[model samples]
Target: MKYLETYRLTNLPAKAYYIPDFISDAEEHFLLQKITNAPLSKWTVLSNRRLQAWPTQLLKGSVLPTTDALPTWLDDPLVQRMVSLDIWRQSPHDRANHCLINEYEPGQGIMPHEDGDVYHPVVATVSLQDGIVLDIYRKTEDGKREIVYRIYQEPKSLLITTEDMYTDYLHGIQDIDVDKSLYRDTVANWDFLSDDTKQRIELSGGDLKRKRARVSLTFRDVKKVRNLAAFLQMK
Candidate 1:
């Protein structure tokens, strides 16, 4: 409880907390293996990235129709630990009901977007394999998006965004291999980053070049859920 405050991104807008080394190397390996070993049909491959949604994808109405619990691999330690941090205290289920695994290769990224209203206004993202810079933007009157903040998420880190930051702003990553000009004044979470991470970036001439593949486990709670089997039987 008290340790969470130490990892808060105080300089950022509304609420965003970054915790480095949130998972151990063994846990990271275990999660990655589980994701890789899942059924091939479980993956939803896009042009830039591939995603795996636990239980199942949402129905046409943006509702979780399966009503099944997340697999054991996603339950213990990770989700359990997240609750201990007090991030999901106000969520509808008081815990995460949905998990989205997004895998990104170097030079690939998702477009800036909001999580929308289907779920609660909170996101717990766990980064694995590589570090990346997440850019937050505010929409301008001229229909252009202006970068407001940049968060550097290291591997095995947990980043939480809630309240205004989750609902008001747009967040996305750049399609580049290296995040350049990473200085204390530019990166919002610089002050909260571990000294080892800072030095590694500095050693690279103020840039963080993504290495290997990276996957993120984004945990959220879907407000609406239905029983697909029951609905089908009734139909």
Candidate 2:
């Protein structure tokens, strides 16, 4: 993946990349099917969205606490493809050990926040079903926050964030049905978007309405893992 540099969001911060059409249509459909068929108990419904944590959720919101590996469906192609980029080469586990499948319905969104230090600084996100705009924020000396950049993530795309881009800024999506003011000048990854996506946004007068729920698969390597060897021995 030496050519990965070509996908870097140069107009934005120090390190972030966007790859449009990272997965084929068949692959997206397959993943969505798997997620759809998962047990109802696996889903943790939240105020604005629903999510499933693979291999188990973090213990006390800080430790991975379980040694169980991600399921084959979550690992094989998605994580494997990320491995090719070497983004986890320096991570504690040298690979992603946790995956969060988050589903956001129309008019739903998350507030701006950082991933924190529980996991490695790198984060790999795969978008499915629909597209959305992520707003990046930086704090001013006056102790207030302001949006500094924006990213339009297309369906079947992969977005990687690390280094300064991971720690130096906050990222979030706005709670709106239609993402407005989208164009080359306002979006960090505009040049990397597919032609069809660009044309659609343009035809809508710089607005892209959200008609379907969007799912994001976020992968990261937790820095802390509890030993389950003794527990396994008794099983």
Candidate 3:
């Protein structure tokens, strides 16, 4: 399949690929169950959302400690598909070593921030449950920011961000109950969404309301890792 022909967002930055229904409903449900069933300690509570850093978070921006491979629930199908896309082929690892599972309840969203230097400049995020709009911003000379674009992420869809789009801009979700002012004119990937999604948005009079909880699994290749022994010695 020609990925570019499937979901093209020309108005935005250098690269952003949106693939609707990238996973089957059963796959989505299985992944969601795995996430929700994780030990309570797996979740780190934030002001607006909760997240689980798989294989453990980075240490000093250079190393990953946990040697256990990602659970099959997190690896199969999804990760396989990602590999097939060759999205991480150019990264140092050639495959994502970490996954950040973020669960956002209604009215909860993350602050606008860049992923920074911890991981390679590519992020492949898979959305589950409800859909939401990702707000992209451009940095200004004075350290202020400006809203540059919006990308709608639907359930079971995959969004890949790379190149200048990843390093040169900041991305986040707004803390709002409803995503308003949605239309082809405002949504950067409006033409790429599934027909059902587009129809629903149109039926809602161009404003998409958020009703269910949403979970996003962001996959990235962490460039740093130390063996368990070395990591333990450094601590």
How would you encode candidate 2's per-residue C-alpha lDDT over 71-156 as one tens digit per residue?
Answer: 99988898988988888999988899999999989899889999999989999999999998889999889988899999988989
Query: What TM-scores do the predictions have?
Result: 0.95, 0.95, 0.94
Error of 2 at 65 (Å): 2.9
The C-alpha stretches of model 3 lying farther than 4 A from their native spots are: 1-6, 232-235
Best by lDDT: 2
Instruction: Name model 1 segments beyond 4 Å from true.
Output: 229-235
Candidate 2 pairs with clashing backbones:
none
Per-residue lDDT tens digits for candidate 3, residues 70-183, read 667778888888888888889988888889999999899999999988889999999999999999999999989988899999999999999899999999999998898889
* Superposition TM-score, candidate 1 onto the true structure: 0.95
- Relative to the unseen true structure, what is the C-alpha lDDT of residue 130 in candidate 3, on a scale of 0 to 100? 96
Stronger candidate by TM-score (2 vs 3): 2
In order, how many clashes per candidate? 0, 0, 0
Clashes of 2: 0
- How do all the candidates rank in terms of lDDT, highest first? 2, 1, 3
* Native-referenced Cα lDDT, model 1: 0.89
Computed on alpha carbons, the lDDT of every model, listed in order, comes to 0.89, 0.90, 0.88
> Can you give the lDDT of residue 11 in candidate 3?
80
RMSD of 1: 1.7
